[model samples]
Target: MPLHSLQRLSPTVLLGLWRLSETPADLWPLLPRAEAYRALLPATADGKRQAQWLGGRVLIHRLLAEAAPAVAAAVQVHNDPTGRPWLDGPGAELTVSLSHSGAWVAAILARGGRAGVDIEEIRDKAQRLASKFLAPAEWAAAQAACTTAAEASTHYTLLWSAKETLYKLAAQRGIIFKTQLLLGEFEPRAAGHIPATLVLSDFETRHCICYSQPSPGYVLTYCHESPA
Candidate 1:
């Protein structure tokens, strides 16, 4: 299939029902060594990235196979110096990123430029780790958005997802989220646009990033020229 078909399907719709039944070992042969490294990560902090890598590849492979025939035989996958992955064969124009927490894996793919995605389960785990990545303003907004610690946890997870997506996008530009990335207020809106800010210190620039709550209890985000 052409890349356009895959682009037309909303990431929410694609990810909403997507599930993986096979293990990384089952799909590693179809991917290159570096690609396989991602899937082979053990279920530990040190291995989480590897898991994300593997999960993203499997998710992309399944989505592409369902979306286009051209993807099946020649969906060449490659990695940047930073270790971000990309498709580089017959359908090389497709850009994708994947993140998984627990049993669920989330992926985003689009033609041209770059795409990123992340998913998190709403729980206290997010709060425990909030201070590590979230800025003070983000914590304040999250606290104001939720009345209880549990709600605060969910809010933080959403913020983390947004920041992560932005981090992946920034990686394409050789930027890092820590120190280099900053976020603004959390606008409460659904579907259309929720206000947030992303500051890239290296470039000394800030961008108004749009966030979308595409599904109940979940946050989804992306960046690219309005889908052609």
Candidate 2:
């Protein structure tokens, strides 16, 4: 479909979502440096992957339209050595994070710092793998708060999605999810903020990550960090 949702999370942060219904041909027209970005994709990429890839840029373009209309049609998405995305071209002052799951793609753009976004399709897998990502107490609290199997699935998926968003914001390699990046006490809701902490060797930083269920089976989480 078209741009699904776009919202200003803060004065300098914008979030956008796009559903993957269009083919690569359809999405290419929505981007500015379409041919250049296409060349950056792996030679082995299939049509679905290409579509998802372009869908993220398309979402970003839409977000820029809302936040920085002057450069919305000029800047292109580029990746650094670590595979983190940023804007390139005239007035390319924003950093971005892109993510796709199943048939949904999401992006976050921040003017003065880093941004991270994650969208996940709710499934039983998150519940099955919760122990590996959630702390012992976190898993227990989530399980106790869930009254039904479906509720547990949504809760676990949000935890994983929230941590993924935090990880993207960190941009530091070799961090473990269960111990280093942790979510504080909270039950899943249709939409709300979750308290989270990123534990470094000698210090820690906390964040209030925002999350929402854009559709029935999907959960979206995003956060932005200002430059230190």
Candidate 3:
């Protein structure tokens, strides 16, 4: 019930966010133990990890419960070999992704396709390491585009979070972030909304990524990918 935001992207696809104000003990009752997610509940999990795991389950339940009780009751979340969390059981009809950053956690559920979501705390790092995750051309573009250190940092965070979302969505092993996942460079837009694109396999695959400042000092992005 702590879902801070929910966007009905489509009839069966939903994007949900939880502020993580509840502790693991508080969330335990809401999230009943199930085989799919039971073992994932780490005994040593602190608040951050607890929210990271529980937020996804709670969001799925609350989002589905909104439409119908039966629809909401089918969610079972488990991880694949890639360690990406997925829904199972009655929830198998949906493809879902979950991410947690700082005090916020995000989950995206698509009725007919896969979804990926990521969030990052904004800080200055681009000036120090843009070249690490970005290509030479992208680094040059970022330098030419951003006018200040603060702007450059936001650019770095956006690029980092964008690739992370794409990687999670792809769930493909052995792909390097800096080289395999390709993203174009653009000025970091602080106001309104800015949309970015991420490409892989030399244009064989494409995904649209949208950025939003869900809270001060944090960046959030989510993408919907169709299975190839």
lDDT of 2 by residue, 1-228 (tens): 898888887788888888899998988888877777777776777988888888887888888888889878888788788777777786477778999988999998888876789999999898999889989989889888899988888888999999999999888888999999988987567999999999989999998889998889999999887665
TM-score (all chains, Cα) for each model = 0.67, 0.92, 0.85
Across 145-183, the per-residue lDDT of candidate 1 in tens digits comes to 888775676667666777777777666474545445577
The reply for model 1, stretches above 4 Å from the true place, is 1-17, 22-55, 66-68, 172-179, 187-193, 201-220
RMSD of each: 5.8, 1.8, 2.9
For 21-80, candidate 3 gives per-residue lDDT tens digits of 887667767864555466777788777787667876777677666644675666667778
Best by TM-score: 2
| Model 2 ranges off by over 4 Å | 226-228
lDDT of each model, Cα atoms only?
0.57, 0.86, 0.73
Candidate 1 C-alpha error for residue 36, in Å:
9.1
Comparing 2 with 3 on TM-score, the higher-scoring candidate is: 2
Clashes of each: 5, 0, 0
lDDT for model 2 comes to 0.86
Native-to-model Cα distance after best TM-score fit, residue 11 in candidate 1, in Å: 12
